[model samples]
Target: MVPEAEFTSYYGRPIVKPSPWEADIPAYLFAGGLAAGSSLIAAGADVTGRPVLRRAGRLAALGALSISMAALVHDLGKPSRFTNMLRTAKPTSPMSVGTWILSMYGPFAGLAAAAEVTSLLPEQVRSRGPLRLVGLLGRPAGLVAAVCAPPVAAYTAVLLSDTATPSWHSAYKELPFVFVGSASAAAAGVGMIAAPTHETGPVRRMAAAGALLELAMEQRMERSMGVTAEPLHHGKAGRLMRAAKVLTAAGAAGTLVAGRSRALAAASGAALVLGSACTRFGVFEAGQESAKDPKYTVVPQRERLEREGPVRYQP
Candidate 1:
C-alpha cells in the first residue's frame, strides 16, 4: 500500500488552484491528437496504395482538426484574440509551439481531405482546372501534414506536464507515451469506422499496439507517483480512469478477434475512441483534483525538504 500523505494549509484551503479552463481544453487535447494520428494513418495508407483507407484517414484528420481549433478558441474567452497565439515564436513556450504546429497542420490536412473529396467527384467536376490542381497537390500536402503530426500529437502532453499542477507535472516522464498511445488508438478507431474491412489491417494493429502502450505506461505512471497518484484513482477522476482502462482492454481484445467481421471491427473501434476520450478527461480531472488538495502540494514539498536536509544558510 502506498503511504498516505498528511500536510496542513491555511484554513484547509488548497495551496495550488485548479485550472480555470473548462472541459474544452481536454476536448481540444483529444481532437488535436486524433487529427495528428489520423494524418499519419492517411500517409501510410497513401504510400501503400490503400485509397479507401487514405480517404477515410484524410477526412477524419480534417474533421478532428476543425473541432480542435473550435474548442481551443472557445476556451480562450476572447475568441477574437485567438490569433494572438501566433504573435510570437518562443522555443521555451509549449503553447507557442503548439499554435505554430496547428497553423501548419490545419491547412495541409484540409488540403489533403479536399483532394480526396475532389477525386471522388464526377469526371466533369474533377476535370475542372482548379480542382485538378487541388487533386495534384493533395498527396504532398497530406504528406507534409503527416510529418507534422507526431509533434502535434505528442506536444500536448508536454504542455500539460510542464504546468504547475502536481499530478500532471509529476507524471511528466510517462505522459508523452500515454498521449501518443491514446492518439494512435483513436486514429485507428476512426479508420475502422471509415475504411473498408479489407484495408483495415494496419488500423487494427495500430489500435492494439496503442492500447497496450497506454495501459502499460499509465500503470507505471500511477505506481511511480505513489501517494500523489491517489487523485487518479479516487473520486470522479478515478471512475473515468477505470472506465477508460476497461474500454481500452475490451477494445484491444476485440480487435484481436474481430477478424473480417465489419460489425466487430466497428464496435471495437468505437470503444477505443470512447476510451481515449475518457483518458483525456480523466487526466485533466485528476490534475484538477490534485491541485485542489493541499496535501498534494504541501506533502511533496515537505518530502523534498526532508530529503534535501533543508536549505543550508550561507552565513
Candidate 2:
C-alpha cells in the first residue's frame, strides 16, 4: 500500500489569517479584566464594612480602567474615531456590546473612585452641599459599576473566540474561565498590595481561588487543543506561560504566609500581577503563532472530517 502524501502550502504562506489586533488589544484585555474584578471586590468590601479594602479596590479599579481605555484607543490608532464606535448599537456584534459595556461601566467606575477620594476631604469640606451630594452618590455608582463588571471581564473571551483564529476558537469553552481566574488574581493582588494586612483576608482568599482556577483551566485548555496546542508551548509564548505558572505558584504560596507582613504581601501581589500579564500576552502570542502555521488549522479540520465524515448538502 502507498503511504499518505505529505502536506504542502502555497509559497510557505499561512493558510489561515492572523488576527488584525496587535499587542495593545491583549494589554487592554488584561487591564479591563483587572478593572472589572477590582470593581466587584470593591463593592464586596463596601458591603462587608472593610473600609481599607473598599478604598484600595476602588482606586485600583479606576486606575486599571483608565489604562485599559488608553490601550484600546491606542489600538484603534485614531483617538477621534473612537466616538464613532458608539454611534451604532448592534446586539449581534461582540465589539458593539463591549463598546456599550465599557461606555456604561467607565463612567460609574470613574465616578465611584472620585466619590471615594472626595470623601477623604476634611469634615468641613465634606459638609458642603455639593460634596455631601457626591458622597451620597458614590455608593450607588459603585454598585452600578459592580453590576457591570462581570460582563466586562468575560466578553473579551467571546470576542476572541468569535474570530476565525484557530487556537482561540478551539479553546473557547475554557478561555473565558481562564480569563476570569486571571482577572480575579489580578484584582486580589491589587487589594493585597493596597489594603491593610488585617483587612486583606478576603483578598488572600480571592488570590488563592483565582490562582487555582487559572492554573487548572489553562492546563485543560492546552490539553484539549491537542496538536494545535504546540504553539502554546514552543518558543516565546511557552516561556511566558511557564514563567506565569511559576509566578502564580509562588504568589499563591506567599499569600499563605504573608499574614500581616507588608513586605511579603507586596512581593506576592507583584508576582500575581506579573503572572496575569504574562498569561494574557502568552495567549495572544500563541494565537498568532497558531494562525501562522497552516497545520494547526488544516489538521484539525481534517480530523473532524475523518471522524464525522463530510456533511451531505441538500440538492
- TM-score against native, each model: 0.95, 0.95
Tens-digit lDDT track of model 1 for 5-121: 566578877788788979999999999999999999999999999998999899999999999989999888776666887888999989999889889888999999999999999
Provide the lowest-lDDT 10-residue window in model 1: 4-13
Q: lDDT (0-100) at residue 46 of candidate 2?
A: 91
lDDT score, candidate 2, position 10: 94
Best by lDDT: 1
Per-residue CA lDDT of candidate 2, range 1-315, in tens? 999955557998888889888989889999999999999989999999998899888989999999998999998888776789889999989899999999999999988898899889999998799888888888899999999999999889888887878888888999999999999998999889888888889899899999999999999999998777888898999998999899988888899999889989988988998899999988898999999888888889999999999999999
Model 1 ranges with Cα > 4 A deviation: 1-6, 312-315
lDDT of each: 0.92, 0.90
After TM-score superposition, the amount by which residue 298's alpha carbon in candidate 1 deviates from its true location, in angstroms, is 1.0
